[model samples]
Target chain A: MAKGIISWIDRRFPLTAIIKHELTEYPTPRNLSYWWNFGFLAGFVLVLQILTGIFLAMHYKPDASMAFDSLQTIMRDVNYGWLLRYLHSTGASAFFIVIYVHMARTLYYGSYRAPRELLWWTGQVLLLSIMASAFMGYLLPWGQMSYWGAGVITNLFGATPFIGEAVVLWLRGDFAVGDATLTRFFALHYLFPFLVAGMVVIHLVSLHTVKSSNPSGINLEDKDNIPFHPYYTSKDGFGLGVYLIIFCWFVFFAPNTFIEAVNNNPANPLVTPPHIVPEWYFLPFYAILRSIPDLLGGVVAMVMSLLLFAVLPFADRSTIPGGARYRPIYRVTFFLFIADIFVLGYLGAQAPTGYVVPMGQVATFLYFATFFILPIVSKREDKWLRARLPQELLAQFDRTNALAKGQNKGDAP
Target chain B: MSDSKSMDKPLDCPERRNFLEKATAVVGGVGVAGASWPFINSMNPSADVLENAISEVDLKVIEVGQSQTVSWEGKPVFVVHRTPAQIAAMQASKGGPDPQEDTARTQQPEWLVVVGLCTHLGCVPTRDNEGWLCPCHGSRYDNSGRILHGPAPANLPVPPYKIVSSETIIIGVA
Candidate 1:
């Protein structure tokens, strides 16, 4: 019987216990919003990307000479290869969309606050890993954009103080972006997703340790919590159904939405396209890089923009509960930051020209300003809002704070 | 309880034990790094890539006022047989972004050789009447391959070359 097998494994390993504890009976906030669905959706996309990527790799050649041709062959000759490729490409974009929403949800809900810092950091690491994987995968097709984009990004290392040139050369495995670079990128692209999957496990572990933060932004009591199996499993399943409909539409109908037209042509280093743009996901950071006049300064600024996420827990030193749930000013600030990011992404797609330069400068300033503004606003808002809070809510807040303070003694709130 | 308490106590040579532990960890760390070096260094330019370092160009075939594109280590090398007017125009103006004299950018004023890729983002600049214009970004380069104006932080790089004979020039060898 299934029970006999499970018990046999459970005696040696914590298999049944793990499933029961971590999946079926795990405590989760009952008031979790649709935004909570994105984490599950991100995990789903990760698996989708891995599966589609494995299938595509079977027919794809990594050599610079044959890379483009191999892709064509996959499209023309291999059965369901186009579907696999499209799904993988579409899944890459979907993964980013899901992660961004998940992160936005985190920021809005103050899920990155104390006791969940490791979870946020793990998510950040996952983002970096996925970005690296996507960058490497972009070069696999050996298209003009792939070649030039890789050249441009790899050249960013050339902005380093001393060992810049050497690092660039080492990265390319040649004087220029060539066969060695393509092969190596292919190898790493295949590698990074597995590493990401491993990190995803860590991310989950961190998440479960602190438990999920709800939109209400309060640590709900045991009575307010619900078991994961029937509640969240069903909810996540419904979210997955919705996500798949959108994903499959892109994969089948608008497969090339994420892919570039210039990427169709084989990589010719001798000719640069009229305009070389990065994939849509990288546009905001690309805009930030272009905003700075100096190469080294731009590279540093771009890198800092990403690293700024890691410091959010420390930066917003507000004792405010319910992140943006009650804070009107903070909500507006959050929306403005999101809009600024959109503007930056749009600007990044355009050529750096007359008005674009000035506009980009303004947007870049706003992008960085949001982070600097957050702490001051959060602290002041906390003071302003605390006076107006109901006595019961204030007492609940105090109790939660006490629990957070006492967490070092290995007690869960 | 007594036996367990005694077991928890320090050994006779605790310092030596600690030293052994530290030494083993250090050795293991070094071993891991040593094992990783080959895989890490394998990504560096290999022998076959290094072998194709030099590219020989037949300068005799290229006519005056004409720019010939030749492959050098898989990068486009622009060999422009600069006209007298072109050389004069380049020598007269100071390059923007990176201020360099025309003479510094070329081995000979009449025979200008530089990597064809744009200094901004490695896009090949198309030849123009006045200079080269990078289509990707709008980086302009003078006839001598010095950056005129635009986002390119530096001039089109001048690859190392030796003028072996009147007919041939060897690129990638000084």
Candidate 2:
């Protein structure tokens, strides 16, 4: 009887074994810091976006006449529809926050170094796709911001050299950003999250192929690593719970906090808002686009900003520091890159005039320079440090390095 | 208590068993009560309720030489009230081969009422001097709800409508 009962209980509760396998069997590098958690957090945010977006789409109207009213209906009528809309809107912002942090984590820890370069490149592409998805979603409501934002962004394609106007018209489906544009944008916006999800799976698969790098910058060499279960699982769960609480707060108490009130008005083609600004996340790139006096140059600058991420693996010279005990210059340059991004974001929000253009150009130059100068700086610094190291310190380093090497060979699968 | 305990030794006392059962019942009762709110909230509208609900629209607000819009079943309905002059211009245009064989085949004459949604992916058609324009996919409709130069595969739908009063119309009713 007792055996039967145990078997029944086991059949009813299979989650335990699954959890154990995920958490205990999976080996995670011991050096992983809080930075590693953002990838998981980004994944969590992606799920949230999909859930909220699916709900919102149920009550949303894609047509021009009813689009505004449909939004109003969702806010006013459908059960918990307001909650769904707010969650989706705010979720977009939160998604960007986590992705930016994830990218920063990569930069700081040199997670973009070799073998993981493809993973980082895929992540960069995913980021660009996310931005595009969000931009298209912003236009679905047919509100003032949706109208003008779509118009301005579609017009950006017109900045291309010879066939710019034709490309812009093709994108618009008409001479302007109207019904055709909104319909296509809605379709693409709805479709992109799934693509991003696919990319994320690939990113993780690639990530797992190479052992995760830790803050110590050390690669795994032995079974000193802990299973991902109770250790990291509990840690990530706690992180998720805290994140959800903040997300819920935004959804419940401050649904419209991120939405501009000016966007509440219907889209007017003839009337241009005094200042046209892209969403906050796009501001840095937008600033770069505007900094160039010529249209072609502005387009090039904007594209370059995104393309730089793909080239990062080869940009910096520092040998993948097996540990963080070295490479101070790389760290400083990483911070400078962050500062440049923030400065560019600020400049993007300002009107294009006087010092804004010049400042943006300087920032844009520095942004590219960080990538171009990294390898040279890393090589020079490594050479200097090797020559200047004391004999005693060098001897100790050699002993520890050999020990680590021996451990690595022993631990290999 | 001694008598009850002695009785419980053989078969559980009725009062004690009843009390324990009631306690379990109360706990389950409270759980059901706690869960009912969100459960009911998620239930879909009944078929009967949906059947009786407003699925059509009235297009009386449309004026001659102007277009009027109404919402039916959460979609836009455009009623173009064309003047005699506008109707004549539509008849004269021959720039492209006509998608519709007979312009006179349409039931509505001076006032054409169509589901304002574009044939290509359903963006609400906006009225300009030329005709109805879909801002979503660039599909355009002529004054008589016929597909003009656009990717629209079909003309705008005309909801079944009737004039209830000089200024009022009822749509989606036979």
What tens-digit string does per-residue lDDT give for candidate 1 at A343-411?
999999999888999999999999999899888988888888888888888888877866765763576
lDDT top scorer: 1
The docking category that best describes candidate 1 is: medium
Q: Give the TM-score of candidate 1.
A: 0.95
List chain B TM-scores, each candidate. Answer: 0.90, 0.60
Model 2 CA lDDT for position A223: 79
lDDT of residue A105 for candidate 2: 82
Residue B122 of model 2: what lDDT?
43
Q: Candidate 1 lDDT, tens digit per residue, B1-174?
A: 998878777665789899999999999999999999998899899999998789999998899999999998888999999999988888898878788889888777889999998877678899987889987668888887888788888888899999998899999999
C-alpha TM-scores of all predictions? 0.95, 0.65
State how far residue A366 of model 1 sits from its true place (Å).
1.1
- Among the numbered candidates, top DockQ falls to 1
lDDT (CA) for every model shown? 0.89, 0.73
